[model samples]
Target chain A: MGRVVIDVMPKPEILDPQGKAVVGALPRLGFTGFTGVRQGKRFELEVEGEVTDEVLAEARKAAETLLSNPVIEDVVSVRAADGAAGAGA
Target chain B: MGRVVIDVMPKPEILDPQGKAVVGALPRLGFTGFTGVRQGKRFELEVEGEVTDEVLAEARKAAETLLSNPVIEDVVSVRAADGAAGAGA
Candidate 1:
């Protein structure tokens, strides 16, 4: 099966408490020199066929509507999963 | 600033309720032809300088120790953010 990857991130202007928590914890965990962090969501959708442009367009529509909240998040990427099985098939 | 992107996914053998819910809801929402959905996390970390190999190494360390639960999640990818404002600067 083909897989499409979707990435949704909080808009740059939005507050991301999860990201804040992570950035805060990094230093305490001794992972330093990080100035900031933003946490987002990634979804992998498996289809029965090849990841054609038609499939990608459908995935993009799904990404904007069901996968992410357009009010606060941006659908940063909607594309084929790289180099994976079925991606190049 | 340079940004590194880390992707974490639930191990294939693990149960993912969120992904289940999404896959279940998709057909109901009139989006079909998708067989499965797996949800994961994406994190963008901003550093003060260029994304050198050393910086990427640090990000990898952070990803393994802090960003993912090795028991349940896999760190799928960790690399410099692509073509963003600070990524190539």
Candidate 2:
């Protein structure tokens, strides 16, 4: 089996309440010296076979159309999993 | 400034409703050949200054204590951002 990892996050222009809340909580929780906090989502998908370019493209399409809301979020990446590139597990 | 990316996710054994929902939705949404979908969180923390080992350790502590629940979730990584290693942004 192969795997594709997709990372999605709110656009920089968008207001992320969850991220803001985390930023606010950190100082209250005694963790300091951090200026910004942006929270996002990560998805690990296990596919039936090799993760070819076609698979990666389809994954990106899925991310763009279904996994994330384009109005406020951005799909940062849709790539084969792990450090190895252009190959499947 | 420096960025520490902390990735948190539900343990492999834990039931992830959100992930399951996505998995179920994909095939209906015309994206097939996927077997598993695991969802997680990614936090990008921009620190005030250089990211020393001390800063990394503190980030790890924050992730362990606040960002992730040890019982059902795991902090996958707490590290300096990007390709460069052992350095600050």
* Candidate maximizing TM-score: 1
i-RMSD of model 2 (Å, 1 decimal):
6.9
Give the alpha-carbon lDDT of every model: 0.87, 0.84
* Tens-digit per-residue lDDT, B1-89, candidate 2: 88898878788889999999999999998999889998988888888888889889988988998888889888877888865322210
Please give the distance, in angstroms, between residue A71's alpha carbon in candidate 2 and its true position after superposition: 0.5
For all the predictions, what are the DockQ values?
A: 0.51, 0.44
Q: For model 1, what is the C-alpha lDDT against the true structure?
A: 0.87
What local lDDT score does residue A84 receive in model 1, on the 0 to 100 scale?
58
Off by over 4 Å in 2: A83-89, B83-89
State every prediction's TM-score relative to the real structure: 0.94, 0.89
lDDT of 1 by residue, B1-89 (tens): 78999989888888999999999999998899999999999999999999999999999999999999989888888889867722210
Model 2 docking grade: acceptable
